[model samples]
Target chain A: MSEPTADLLVVEDDADVRASLERGLRLSGFAVRSAQDGPGALRAVHERVPDAVVLDLGLPGMDGVAVVSALRAMDHDVPVCVLSARDTVDDRVVGLEAGADDYVVKPFALAELVARLRALLRRGARAAPATTPELGEVLAVGPLRVDLARRTVHVGERAVDLTKREYELLVVLARNADVVLTRERLLELVWGYDFATDTNVVDVFVGYVRRKLEADGTPRLVHTVRGVGFVLREGG
Target chain B: MRRSPSDSTGAVPLSACSPARSMSLRLRVAVASALSATVVVVLAGVLASVLLAREQTERLDRSLVPGSPAVLGSFASTRADLAVTLRGPTGTVRRVSGPELPLSPVGIPTSVTVDGVDYRIRTAPGPTPGSLVTVGATEDDTRARVAERQRLVAGVGVAAVALAAGLGWLLAGRAVRPMRRLTEQAATLDDTTSAVRADGSRESEELADALSAMLARLHAEQERSTASLHAARDFAAAARHELRTPLTAMRTDLEVLRAHPDLPERDAVLDDVLRAQGRVEATLTALGQLAAGDLPDAGGGEPVGVADLLRLAAEDARRAHPELAVVVEEPGADVPESVRAALEGLRMALANAVVNAVRHGRAGSVVLGAHRGADGGVVLTVDDDGAGLPAGEREAVLGRFVRGSTAGGPGSGLGLALVAQQAARHGGGVRLEEAPGGGLRVSLALGPDRAG
Candidate 1:
């Protein structure tokens, strides 16, 4: 219909659902590519990375959570919006903890999925553009250090490779080190989402940031305040 | 077949049967009384006969005058078998009448036989100087009269024994009637009905009361089992009906897609189909978990730390809904014991509550915590900051296939039901109340023994 702003990779085991998603996304002005299973999805990304990935959690071979973990482990910064048939909290949390950016339940409107992908791409651009702008380079919060200029992170002596969304989320937390920021505040600052729609994108990114930052066995710097939000402090 | 005569009353109560097989109690008592009567009667008859015979012999001796042998001779002639004798100072004996008799100096009545005839003889001194007189009488008449009287006593004794036996049997039958009724009633007892009225001696009444109590207990057990069976059947039927809703929607969507291969609105139809599919999948998963929850465990699963459980649930809540702020309250005391349910099942139940808050209540924040309840039970709670359920609908929402009034869209409706099921399995219960922050607070309380 118009010039596609970005490319999307659709991974699903069901043939009809996959075909329909690809067709629907293409019609909605996204250059869409398709994969039937987990290995194919990985290979497709390896050949040429897409701007975004639409992953189905239930795959015939490897599970959707595994694929997400693998993508994050490879240091790929492309945002992943998960699609799952299960609507339980445990199921969703597993996917988010595996490093997915956003998730949409199965049978979601094509328009909504497309909108989420556009928002993710736009956030990526705003988080770190191709022409890196001059700004405060290093963010230090106790033993955790976030190098904004080079888009790298470290805990004490160990270096950590973070996805783009994770990096943006970490920078926000590091900037407001001692202050507790609510989920709404984080979404507005990091993803530029103004209107609330019952999405947990902020929490998911926080989970990713915490996992990567704490991977080196450093003391937890991000503390959660019951019924409030999160705080990055020294002790607890 | 050498059966006893009493066997004719085959269904008689055990109390009525005599220990001795040879004779019944009635006959034994009758025979004992008859023997006593016979002993008394025969003793009295013998005493009367002996006294009467002694008096008659004394009179005969009085009638004999020692003045002359003529007086003695007349007395002997008065009775046919009587004999009179005369003795001189020289010890000579001569018979005056009847038969000749032995002469002796001793003068006492004695029994003798003369000429093959039994006689009662008395001798005394005669009135003539230096003369002695003797008189004798027959004992045959006295013996014959005693024999006839003894036969009469024996006949009366026999009659008394028969009458006593008949009376004893009749009394025993009346005394055992209550026991016989009890036995018949007990033999026909069943589960559906139990009616025992004890109207007899105090002991028999007590026995009947005990039997009634046992039958009541049995009836209660049977009713409980039947009620549970009915509940299981109802649950199955309701589950089927719930699944059919999603299935019907899915079929319709699929049919629509097939009818319009190149329809412009294909994406919307596909979305609807997928949504229906998701509902079906969720309902199926919930049904499976519910079944697992219903199963009885051999032993309560290993204990889980309250702190760890709360933290895990908070983390999960945060991950699933990044928009909702989830916080874990620090526990006041460390719960050394684990939850009484399977770890996985408990976790599932807690996670479902958190999700319900975010998805249905649209809660922007949630707080999860655990503490010892006032009743010394472990309590796990999830408080949300969304529109809470109405006071009336709170209980109803816990039932399977029952959605909250404020539920935004389609839901499996088994989430809260699963929580309730797990609570019951652990000998616990779930409660819903308005949170202090203006939303719903779900509390799951489990007995302390659940930790085992």
Candidate 2:
């Protein structure tokens, strides 16, 4: 999938892990830059922003989450794929919530990480047309409204706040309104993952979306179809 | 310590033992009454006999008055039950018609023997000058009358004594009824008996109340110890269950490595092995912290500054995650002067919150702050810009081994649990809420000193 060498920055705390990732990614036909700590990673990015950044969540000083926040604060639109030794939902959500494009848990397959990085870079290059509807397009179901261009949602007169993943899930469900989309289908459609088996990430994000949407005691919109999946409709 | 013949058998022969001693309260009362009754009867009999003999002698003296009508009539009528006599003035002796009473001319009464019979006699000056008058009562009739009166008194006295003794025995038996019941109830004492209702006397009721109170105290002590024992057992069991997972993973990974030293994905395999080991280590540390949290405070704890603790936590978070922007907000007004808490424990709890914000929330900026909680405790909060946990899981995440569905990373799953444990130990609690910047804000409220 690489026609030209992709520029990448690798930030990690462990020396051996950093060395291995640098070597492996380099041999996999990519330009790799390495930093051992948070400050070093930030300096590397300030010097010259890479095409993509591979960040480790744990660092000696200034962890990966802070690094991502700094990059975003600096208006660096470069794609970020975080590497976390802590394989927990909170850690992944934190990275993504801080504007990281994706995350790879530690002890993960090198090939899988490479694949995710490639996918992130690819997404950064071209807009995700399937996930993002036509510009300025607004989809409405009952009191709920989604503005594709502004990336915002409203129910009645109130605007609902949603996390990035939650927004993605809502968009997917709204796009296929009144349809009972199974968990597998939602995972594939929203997360762009065909093999998210045994993961409740979809359900979790759906929960987030539902809570934000109905926070004001609004009528239920995201109705769950037990033993199946979920559906978005106005009423029963 | 030597065993004697009796000690060896642990029993005494019935024949060698004392008789079936009637030392009961009823027997004692009966014996006491009988002894008093005997003394009264003897005293009454002696008194009655003396009174009767004096009366007989007085009657005979009246008859010897010489001019007394009743005395003259008795002498003229020749009453067989009485006798009278007179004597000339000088050195005269008198013989009473009753059984020949022997009497000297003296103004006195006397008891004497006449004709082998008992007699009461009296002598005095007669109406004629220098004349002696004497009177006598027949010994048989007077003696018989005295004896009969004494016998009747004795019979009545004996009857009275028997009645008194019988009544005393019966009343004693009635009075000791409650005591007997109390002894019987005490003999049957067991764990299942809730209370002893002493139905007899006031003293017996007091004894029962005392025994019941003792039983209740013993029961409470037993219950308390049993509960603590169960708690310890549960702690061990929970620790075992929590440790099993990582240990199993490590074992499998180690077995794989041992089987294939030259595996193509040796680096990846090694990483897996290390990850498993890290999990085990993390779990062990968490277990230690949990045990620390479970310990009861020894009291006399020094007060801790709430604001200072928050600041320290922020600094620690910054040092650990240098890239993460951590700020200590201005301390809120009206906050407690100090919270009574274990310093190290409170510090660890605050640190856990910061780590949660930095590691789990992926917070861009963490702000540590303090305020006075509604419950009058010091509320220290760590606010992050990372994604907050779902509202439903806010409470669930505080329990041990309960990872939030939103959490991602290698976690011992005891981070928040330790925070909760510390809060509980300090007589406080932890609350989770949404932060200002769409992230989680974890608040640790430490109670103030109880003395306050």
Candidate 3:
């Protein structure tokens, strides 16, 4: 009708589900392209990087985790939301660890999925385009240093390698050094999740950032506040 | 009721007195050996006392008899306990020395009491025609010696019995060592241990072997149940996912219809929703059938005719798919009239196979056939001239919720699995092979035991 809000890709093995998802997303004011498997999803992304990707975790050939890993390996930096039939914690943890931004179990409400996709798209638009002039600033907390423009990190003299989500989480925590951020607050600020979800993804990502920051046996900069969330400070 | 408490209390002392009830095997063996030893020792002591008393009495009697007057006089004078006397033929005592000897039977020795002392006296023929010679001795000295010997024998018997009891206890301890070790090992057995070992005695070794065999069987049974439980869990998980996929689509379509009431292409959207709903219903039905098949059959098997099965399957195929050609091949004359099988289950399995051919295989024509198998059983086959699956996927598709690569259209993926389940229930198996002139052939072979 008017202008589509963003371009989205839906990848699922089930033909009926893929068609329904594509139609629903398009009707929700987004341009949609679809694929039925992992390799096809990758090919579609290679041809044109979508604003966001909706993926199913179980596929016939390569599966959704490998797809997410491949997308990240190619440095796409696109926001990905996974659909899983399994409601186990380990399943969500595995998908998130493979570079997925968010996940919703099957039989979820369309409204909920739409709301999460909107949040992710909004964040992607802001985070995309590394050439933005304001990104030249650097975030430093103790031995950790993050160059936002180069998308690089270093702890003292040792350069640290991190995934896209891990880097975003570290940057958010460093920007609020000495300030305790709850899990909910971090989910909203770092992952752009405005909706309430009982997910431990924030904890999982924080662990990744902590490992990389302390790889050289440096003093701990991220401290957990027990019942509270976490803080980025000079010392525990 | 009031006497019950006192009755129970009174029974406690009786139980306590019988220590054999709770005795250990080693201790019981030792006690039994000691009891037998005591019996033998006491019997031997009694026999020795009887013989000793008779021998002492005989020796006293021999000494009482005198060979001649000089010998008798000397024998009498040698011991204060002995006396010699002369008696006339009329049994009258004439002369006596020491104590008066009683006139006893001629040439016989007899025990008599004289002056409040026991004496053994014997009378023999004298040197004169009417005279008799009598010699007598007191029994006190002989009895004293015998009493001393008997006391000594009793003391020795006591020592022997004590020694026998001690030796029995020690020997029994050594003999029961292996049995005790075996008992300890058996007590410590647990689920993790698969074997029992006892190298002690023949009986203990045999007991250990039996125990190990039992443990192995139990372990195998436990593992089999565990595997089945895992299979059931995995099937549930797969069913859930299969149902959810369709439900998700249907929900999305329904939501879109509600969101946009006047949207164009509404009929198409409605059709998609209906199709997804149908898929969900089909999946649920298939899941129910699979679960039913998983349980042990309550109504056992019955005699099913070979030709009847084929003809019924052909009719079913024709009714379900009117556009497709259906044929029933005649069974061979050598084939048996009937075989034992779950009739309803076999009918359902065959119906599902026909449905698979028409829906997934896209077969225009189907053939139902039956004949005697090489194993002296029956073989039922469904041949379809449709798209056949690759060789590798044929085996996998028989499992629950697995589909063939060449399968077309939406299916519950449980048709072939149902067939496989029925085949197994009949003590047989299912195989997929190439039919003549292309297409697929499904061969279900029943075991020879099922032939009736």
Q: Estimate each model's TM-score.
A: 0.42, 0.48, 0.83
State the lDDT of candidate 2 residue by residue for B1-452, as single tens digits: 34446634633233224434347677898888988988988898788889888896566556544455345546635777566665656746433344444555486667777667665666667656776666666567656777888889989999989988998899888877777776666667777876777766787788889888988898888889999999878666556545544443444445445555775776775786587677778779878888877878888467767666777777778787889898888776787656777878877887777777766777789888887788777777888899789899999889877767566555666889888998888777899999877899888877654312
lDDT by residue for model 3 over B273-299, one digit each (tens)? 999999999888877877777778665
Instruction: List the candidate numbers ranked by DockQ, top first.
Output: 3, 2, 1
Q: What is the DockQ of each candidate?
A: 0.01, 0.02, 0.58
Q: CAPRI band of model 3?
A: medium
Can you write out model 2's per-residue Cα lDDT over A1-236, one digit (the tens) per residue?
Answer: 43578999999755445656676677566799999789999899889889989888866458788998898888786778786655457767777667676666555566566666665566555545655667879989999999988888999999987655567678888888999999989856655555544445566566667877889999899999999999999988
TM-score of chain B of each: 0.57, 0.65, 0.81
Candidate with the greatest DockQ versus the true structure:
3
**Residue lDDT tens for model 3, A1-236:** 34347889999988788888888888888889999889999999989999999999987769899999999888888999999988767777678788898888888777778888888887777666643537668988878888987878999989998877888888888889999999989989887888897667788788877887888799888899999999999976
Whose lDDT is greatest here? 3
RMSD of each: 28.5, 18.5, 6.0
